[model samples]
Structure formats: structure tokens, C-alpha cells
Target: MSPIVVPSRLKLFGLVILILFLCFPYGGAAYSPHMASVVRISQIYSGGGNASSPYGCDFVELFNSSSVAV
Candidate 1:
């Protein structure tokens, strides 16, 4: 067999894609004025606590920022 060779244009395109992926933000932002899902997981508590622990249990709290009912 022989070593594979990549075209210069293809390499440049790959570099551009990598730069874009690194420079720009991935996934949705934390807060948005015009967001679809208003409900968010405000707090998360996991694992059972020890001698002086509050609540003493795991719980996931959700908060609704929007006024409309979900």
C-alpha cells in the first residue's frame, strides 16, 4: 500500500471548520430573550448527605422564568 495524501484545499477547509468550531459558541446560550423553553433546572442536589446535612436527599429543582404556565 501507500501513504494517503490530502489536497491543500481540503486541508484549508478543515482548518477553517476547526477554527469556526473553536471560535464560536457551541449549543444554546444560558439566557435568551426569545427562548423556546422557559423552564430550566435552577438547582440540582444529589447524593445522600451525612451527619449535618440539609434536606438529606437528592433533589432537582426547576424554575420557570416565563410568566405563562408550562
Candidate 2:
């Protein structure tokens, strides 16, 4: 018996569909207005006491653009 082979285009289309299915939820989640309000802040503090605080002491500020709290 001869081995069967699949076409590359069909394989690629299948892969794209699979990826879209897996990512659909994540993509939908990202579109939420709540996500737009979410903010990520980072600060680095020097170990030494003498080190001057950056920005008058490292801090993080989260702004809620939306009325709802996340």
C-alpha cells in the first residue's frame, strides 16, 4: 500500500483554524473595556540606604479609566 500525503495548503489552513480557536477567548478577553483600564507599573529600589529615591520614592499609580473597578 502507498502512503498518503496531505496538501500543504490544507495543513496550513487547519493550523490557522486551530490557532484561532485556541486564541478566541484570549482575544475576546483583551477587548474588554476593563482591560483598557488595567495598568501595570514597575519600580526599582536601590539596596543602599544612601541611594536617592527615584521619582521621590519609587511608586506605582493605577488609573481606572472605566467606572468599574477591576
Candidate 3:
């Protein structure tokens, strides 16, 4: 029939425990197989205006779509 008063330290501890319980699964970074499969490609095109160049400006680039840079 009455409210219970909890000490400040106890309250803080309870809050921390609650947060950890709610966030433990997602607190750290996660990886997805679908994202791992992603790939990026970059290409360069050459035009007739640069016919004098011995090598056309042709290049290729690749990238990964994960949170980590590769």
C-alpha cells in the first residue's frame, strides 16, 4: 500500500542492468551475409577526342559494401 524508496546507487545499478539487457545483442557491430556479397565497380571511358593518347583512360575499381572499408 506504499511506494518503496530505492537508494541512488541501487537505482543506477538497476538502470545499467536494464540497459545491458536491452542492448547486449545490438551493442556491438553486426555483419550480414547479404552485405558481404555486395560489390562495386568503377570504370573509365575513353572518347574519340583522345585518340592521340597511346593508352586510353581505362580503369577499373572494386569495393565491398560492409561497414568496414576494404
Candidate 4:
């Protein structure tokens, strides 16, 4: 019968580290546009802002698929 060689704890740990490095390949503090979202002009008004206007300036309304506001 052939002998089976079980890896030592330290060797196993190193193997796990190598596997992680190989799988991830790189690291960084990064963001994805897909995870976030893109905002689009939902509405627009032609009138200039006045004292009567609540929003101030010629305002534009933006919208996105996400419920969370930016």
C-alpha cells in the first residue's frame, strides 16, 4: 500500500494562504458602478427660482432604481 502524507498545520496554513492569494490575485479599496447606481433626470422645470419657490434655482429632479437616496 502507498503511504499517505498529511500536511502539517503550518504547511496547511501556508497552502490556504497561497490559495487565497491565487484566488483573489489582487487587493484594493475599490467601488463598483454596478453596486452603486446611476442617476437620471426625472423631471425639469423651466421657471427661474423665486422667493415663492421652495427648492431655489432652476431645479432638476433626479431618480434611480434604488430606494436609497444619495
Q: Of the candidates shown, which would achieve the greatest TM-score relative to the real structure?
A: 1
Q: Give TM-scores for every candidate, taking all chains together and pairing residue i with residue i.
A: 0.40, 0.35, 0.33, 0.34
Comparing 3 and 4 on lDDT, the stronger one? 4
CA deviation > 4 Å runs, candidate 1: 1-36
lDDT, candidate 1, at 51:
65
**Clashing pairs in model 2?**
none
Write out the backbone clash pairs for model 1.
none
lDDT of 2 by residue, 1-70 (tens): 9988999999999999999988895666546554755654444444334456344454445555555657
Lowest-scoring 10 consecutive residues by lDDT in candidate 4?
28-37
Please report the candidate that would top lDDT against the real structure.
1
lDDT of 3 by residue, 4-62 (tens): 98999999999999988888867777887776578676555454348686665655667
- For candidate 3, report its TM-score: 0.33
Give per-residue CA lDDT, model 1, range 1-70, as digits (tens): 9989999999999999888888775743466556657888998877657666676888999888988876
After superposing candidate 4, which stretches have Cα over 4 Å from the reference? 1-7, 28-30, 37-70
Ten contiguous residues with the weakest lDDT in model 1? 27-36
Which lDDT values do the candidates have, in the order given?
0.80, 0.64, 0.72, 0.76
Residue 37 of model 4 has an lDDT of 57
Q: Which model is ahead, 1 or 4, in terms of TM-score?
A: 1
